[model samples]
Target: MIQTGEKELKGIIPGSWHILVKFWPQIRQRKLLIGSSLFALLLETALGLLEPWPLKFIFDGVLLSRTDIYPDILGFARGLSPMWLLSLLAVSIVAIAALRSITAYLSTYGMALAAIQVLSEVRSNLYSHIQRLSLSFHQRFKSGDLIARVTYDIERLRLVTIKTALPFLANVVTIVGMVVVMFWLNWELALISIGIFPLFAITTTNIVGKIRKETNKHRTSEGAIADTTSETIGAIRVVQALSLHDMLEENFLIQNTKSLQEGVRSLKLATFLEGLVKVLMALVLALVVWRSSLLVLQKTLTPGDVLIFVNYLKTAFDPMRQISKQIGQIAKAIASGERAIDILDYEPHVRDLPGATKAHPFYGSVSFEKVSFSYDPSRQILHEVNFDVEPGQQIALVGPSGSGKSTLASLLLRLYDPTVGGILIDGRDIRSYKLDSLRQQISVVMQDSVLFAVSIRENITYGRLGATDAEVEHAARLANAHDFIMDLPQGYDTIVGERGGTLSGGQRQRIAIARAAIRHSPIVILDEPTTGLDGASEHAVNEALNRLTRGSTTFLISHNLRAVEGCDRILYIEKGEILERGTHPELMAQAGRYAHLYRLQNDTNEIEGVKHVLEA
Candidate 1:
């Protein structure tokens, strides 16, 4: 979802007005449409106020024949017969309603269009911002929740903008116009009609805060449900193999039930407010009718004046009832808008500095100068690590799991900067170069290289976008992936499933190698690239890797000592420090940690090989 600052999260939730102010820039972009909509709204409110007056004139002048009290604006109607006057007033009512309907349509359509355009742009920008956030930030948050904020939360805001905001604005203007007219008709009756407003305001104000709180709770619960569903679906194969259905379902059901409870609680508060508004409105109506009847009997007011007063009261109070009914939805939209604002306001922890410039073509000399790093302060992952690799050299880093071998590769690529020292390329600190330019000069193939659900050609071209079809095929061939790709029905055009699930482990690794090959970067990193593959697949992937990294500065992080035996130099690291560094023969001759591990690994391999022979 939106990445809120710690301090911002602890503060009070902002009101709807504050949310609107935050989004005012986007709204201001559509000023022309908003202006036209406002004009239409004013016109529509004017017509609605005029609606009851036609009937007023008919009651007082046409039926009762009260010409003395007739409005000066309608003096011409005095000369007409009662039948003609009644006919004219009826036609005026229909005319006023038709005009009001047209204006209403114009205003509604304009606002809805503006809302859609503005929100769609906001959604796109949020998605882009999320992608650029630091990898640490992504690891800390659930992807499903982020998806919920980008899609569902923004959608909630759009719906409220169209369905609730427009009507609320129109009703506000109508209320103001009706109130002014009511006072003009009779000051005493107007006072009685509006006297209940404070009670209505107090009732709504007291309950609205609770409704908003419950809405926030409901939204949080929904996000949790989304995270659960996303995590389960992403690892469906593992869940099915492990028989985790019942356990996962139980967790999902808890979130679902909590969401329902909070949702219903918010709705119940809104409903109570609506019922309270109706009661307050009824009280005002009763007092106005009773007082107006006495005035009519005493000849202080005309029958038509009483009729107009009651009509205005009902019209004015109707908007209050509608607002009360919609409080829950409005609160939900405000919560969602706050979430979106939080993300947009967040600055990426790692971004290009003001003076950063494009990096020049690198000769692939990499140096880590006393570099120390950690994902968190509680535990350091890498400590005082010093190393250097010349251009065109192949270095192997053999370490136990979690010994920071892959983290060193990550630091070289600038995914995360070293906490205590600098990484330099071609003798220049990497931070001096723009992030995108620096990263473009290096390539990586992780143990589980991810591929999108697209054609094989498209996946490879992602390494260096705009690579031609011929270049893609050449890269595939270099990686030893061309034969199997061609055997497929669609050749290079064959679509891969998500994460390349449709392909065998060997085939996926070969495609990933091709992607790295197409980049043609001077620096390459292979992190356990053949970890889980069978012997045949491992051999094929190793062959392809050799072709791809032929002239590049390559750092190979692997557990299999056999692969490292061929590298020009090998570094045996443990506990975030390089324990030994030498050529394979030299390390073996020294009989240090590297020699001990190498002999143990080879012994295990020999035993496994003999067992395989006997079984055959």
Candidate 2:
């Protein structure tokens, strides 16, 4: 189906043309394949032109005894008996038909192969670019919309070679050859046939223009449907919990209905263009036949000559008909190309600079120096945040939900660069290191531990490529996941469902820990790693965390007060600043915000304990 947008086609005429011109280099890279395809196309056209000649010989020489008509054209039929001449012409027609079929197959298949190769490369490049873009870029666009641009949009571009280029080139060659031979046989009839082309062109351009506009709308609606479906399905758990099935269905129906209406409108316009072309073709054919009959009766042209003229008339206009029919498909492809180019033309905001150096393995020392950040200038998320961590230190960050705790972790990962000032690792500005190399030194596990729908082993080893089987098991054991993994039917080979939904919340967190454990990075960030676990699962995970944190510089973010007591130091963060920084007991002695919140939680726990004892 056609997939594109109107704004995507804002400069589409020039934009699509530029994309086609840019693709010329890749197309030339497949010179041998395309050359063979072009040769086959030319051969097919030649074979098509030969098809009517045999009929002409049979009509004039064999049936009407007009042997003088094509004495030189069909030299074999000149001296043969009528029956033998007809047989010769019949054999020639069959041979031409067979060759045409072979050439048509070769041309279509060869072009399709080359188109697939070029678009495959395009898709690979586009996907890689999207992956490299900053988090802000992804935030601006939906995953489903990006997915549509990379897949369906690229597919539409591939259609250009098969639907537009192949047909246009082959048809043009056949039309030119037929027109020349038509003029040679009867110039007057040929003129009458060619005269209808201007009107056809005018009608085609007008109708196809409308079709293209409607197609843009339809394609956009389809993208909206895709985005809505992706978002809904991704949050299917919440949707089911909130009983939003009818609401989501109504929302999808609105998008789908718009798409259906636009699709019908585009189809109607295309049908009108096709019908208009058919009428034009009939008129041209009628004019050619009328003029050819006059010439035949006037003794200026033989019956066979009139037959060739009529056949040539039909053959010459066939390309125009085909092109008119293909115009809608061509427009859709152009719109898609424009959208693909939109992504290709984007400059990633967070790419490594030229001459960027590969980072040495981090010694685990990290510092945020007067760093500031804002998604918008008016409302800053992190304001002049400053902090320092010694090598192999375990620092706990405690704060309200929007108090910039996760933002700090994100900055350390360099998923974003600070708007002002800088962050340093081992006394080197993080931006000075190659992005990939810098990221390799730090491992992260967030609240929602995302896992692919792959085998449990594959998901774990994703943190450290080329990890041996034994090493994978070791990491799993360290994360308290090995026993449960062994209980599964496939042991470590069991396939996890999407986002690891097949596993329980605690199971998923343990797997995430196992994945992080295998990384063996000197720096690890656990943001609410054990937040949603049960009492037993939390205890198990906390024990695993104790083992995993040994000798590693750890940044632990959590809301559970009890979870932070074991850290070497706890930082009470509020409103983008550290309100308190000390050991758990040290903070309690100070009687600050941290002490007040801690004692309040302790009082609530004591009350719960007393109530439980009384009920027993």
Once model 2 is optimally superposed onto the true structure by TM-score, how far is the C-alpha of residue 33 displaced, in angstroms? 0.5
Tell me how many residue pairs clash in candidate 2.
0
Weakest ten-residue segment in model 1 by summed lDDT: 1-10
Give the Cα-based TM-score of candidate 2 against the true structure: 0.86
TM-score of 1: 0.87
**Which residue pairs in model 1 clash with each other?**
1-146
Model 2, 1-616: lDDT tens digits are 1222233334446755788686777777888998899899999998888888888878878888986777565666677898888888899899999999999999999999999987888888889989998998999999999999998899878877687868977877888888788778777877887788777766776676678779889989999999999999899999999999998999999999999999999999888877777788889888877877887889898777777776776666658766654655665687787788788888887879888899998899999899988877888887787788999999999978888899889989988888898999999999999998988888888889999999999999998889999999999999999999999999999999999999998899899999999988899999999877888998888888888888999999998788899888898888877878999999999999988988888999999999999999
RMSD of each: 4.9, 4.6
Error of 2 at 408 (Å): 1.4
- Write model 1 residue lDDT over 442-488, tens digit each, in one string: 88888998999999999999999999999999999998999999999
For candidate 1, the per-residue lDDT at 246 reads 100
